[model samples]
Target: MNRIGAHLLAGVFRGFGTNAKVIETYEGLDLGKEFTSGKECFPCIVTLGDILLFMKKERERLGNRFNPENYIYFMPESDGPCRFGMYNKYHRIVLDSLPGLDKVKIATLSSEDAYSLSGLIEKEKIQDFRKAAWLSIVTGDILDRLLWRIRPYEREEGMTDRFIDEAMERMTESFSKHSSGKDLSCILNDLVEIVCEAKKIIDPHIPKKPLIGVVGEIYVRTHLKSNQDTIRTLENYGAEAINASIAEWINYTTYDQVR
Candidate 1:
């Protein structure tokens, strides 16, 4: 019976429906229009555009092997500081507008409560905690570094996006097979070492530059258009600007709550 179950499981995994294409939708929205006029608004349309682009790329990559009906796009939501709590609704609305995407699941992870779609998934597969933690850390780091580096170089026509996409693909492939507790620690250490090396590689220039600190709603700070090219404008004026990452913010918030 065990052998039969193993064979069946193998068959299922080999099929397209067995593997889910998880879409990270937290940073998908680009809410630049609302922030331009100093408006405290949530940019649902921008977020929708980001998700659509991701879905299109996924479909192209997987072709017939992509099981759109079985895939899930995870969107994290919170109920504080702004109207961001409605991000899931906005995401669904936007997703519905796109053709052939009616069946895609747009699930939510709420920061306000302990119970969330992600939490439930994690709880149901309790033994997969190690895998989940490793994924959350590694992907969060990679996205953070990529966003920080690419945002500054994005122009009307540039190759930063292509570079980022390729890097993300590589990272994702590497992450899939590495989730054991020992492996997770080793990966985290390796990531820190790499970042340190990266800083060294780019440390030769101490140009007299202005330093600007960007702070605001998560969407505004990360979205290029929302801050009205604030970072670019700062760089144009010979300033080195920094945008704190949402991942770091979340990590700190979680840590503080535990304390």
Candidate 2:
């Protein structure tokens, strides 16, 4: 999953008092593989592992107080040809098999209705939530592009990553504070400032490298471990790379519905 997008989306949920958090990825991969017959796509396995691992840790943290009803496992679905539609059901079966995990609810948004939030949240706040989510996702896409553009030519090694980390924090905070409001101007202003500051990390003296465009399955393309840090690896070999943005997929689903 796109780290920026996931974090910002979680922040948007928090703005509405949902207390959402992004799960740690790739760490629970073995658990995912353990549960599967290796017949599913890599993304499904990895994500399942992430949730399983998170729930395991949460159970340990809470000792006996862990209430499955208190948490919701959010996994969006697609009505498209891909097997993505079956993932939620498959994961439900897996979760139900695990002792005490059966009570943990799974939440989903489908592409069939352009990911309508009708049942997920209160009717009065659905539009506001959707608008905030869109703005957060767009911000994530912009931040990711900024990272790829400057990281390759950063004046100091690790400086770009460090700056981006700080920038993500600031943006997350901004989202939580302004996302509930009708006007998105405050969030846009903050994003602009972060992008402007990101530009300072680039060293103009470095010669440009060959451009490479990465296109593939969304999970493999965005998840670093799944793709083995393909973009960063390309940069290491004297090329700059830009992967497709998550926003593009969201837009496509919307367009598909209209057509």
Candidate 3:
């Protein structure tokens, strides 16, 4: 997942009383590459390495206190020809083959049911959790849009990124605090104010650049490292870039399931 999206999702989980965090990614690509055939999708390999690296570091830190059974890895999947649908199963194989990680649980939210939480979470809390998750994802998408929209026309270099960082932090805190109530009005209002502030960062004197629409495999397009900072590159070349949103896939899967 992209950074903002990942963090906001974690906040959503925390709001529902689940402790979740996005692990450092890309740094463990070598470990992920080593475990799988080179044929796997790049994002799959990257995520595989990320979990492996996190687990290894945690085990080293906790030593005897490390309990793989106490952890549940959340890896969502879709139903389709995309290899993404099989990531959890493949990760399961890798985790099982590893000595200490075999006991760690892998929890999946499937698109087959529009990512229903029927078995993974308490029955009574399912509706609220799903609603919060949806809103959090939408917020994450908006944050990304805010960055791309303003950064290219910023009043000063690096100001857009710094402001976005602050916005993401504030939004994450809001999500964590307000999601439990199952009423996202407060979160939405905060987002509106953030957007208004972001608009102020844009310079009115700078003419708009050629607009570029980026579309591709969700990971490659959104993951800065995977795409080698494609969006920034476009902005540097005097173009504004907009990538597809993460929420689009979530919506598509639901529509597909219904069809």
TM-score of each: 0.59, 0.98, 0.98
How high is the lDDT of residue 58 in model 1? 78
- Reference-based lDDT, each prediction: 0.51, 0.91, 0.90
Q: Weakest 10 consecutive residues, lDDT, candidate 1? A: 1-10
Query: Given candidate 2, what's the lDDT at residue 191?
Result: 88
Candidate 2, residues 132-207, lDDT tens digits: the string is 9988898888888998999899999999899988988999999988888899899999988988888889999999
Write the residue-wise lDDT of candidate 3 on 1-259 in tens digits. 6789888888988888888888888899999999989999998999999999999999999999999998999999888798888999999999999997899999998888889966767789889888988898889999999999999999999999999999999999998899879568999999999999899999999997998999999888889888899999999999999999999998899889888
Question: How far is 56's C-alpha from truth in model 2 (Å)?
Answer: 0.9
Off by over 4 Å in 1: 1-42, 52-68, 93-102, 114-174, 180-183, 203-205, 225-229, 251-259
Q: Tens-digit lDDT track for model 1 on 164-196?
A: 454444444434444423345544554455444
**Which residue ranges in model 3 land beyond 4 Å of their true spot?**
none
Cα RMSD to native, each candidate? 9.7, 0.9, 0.9
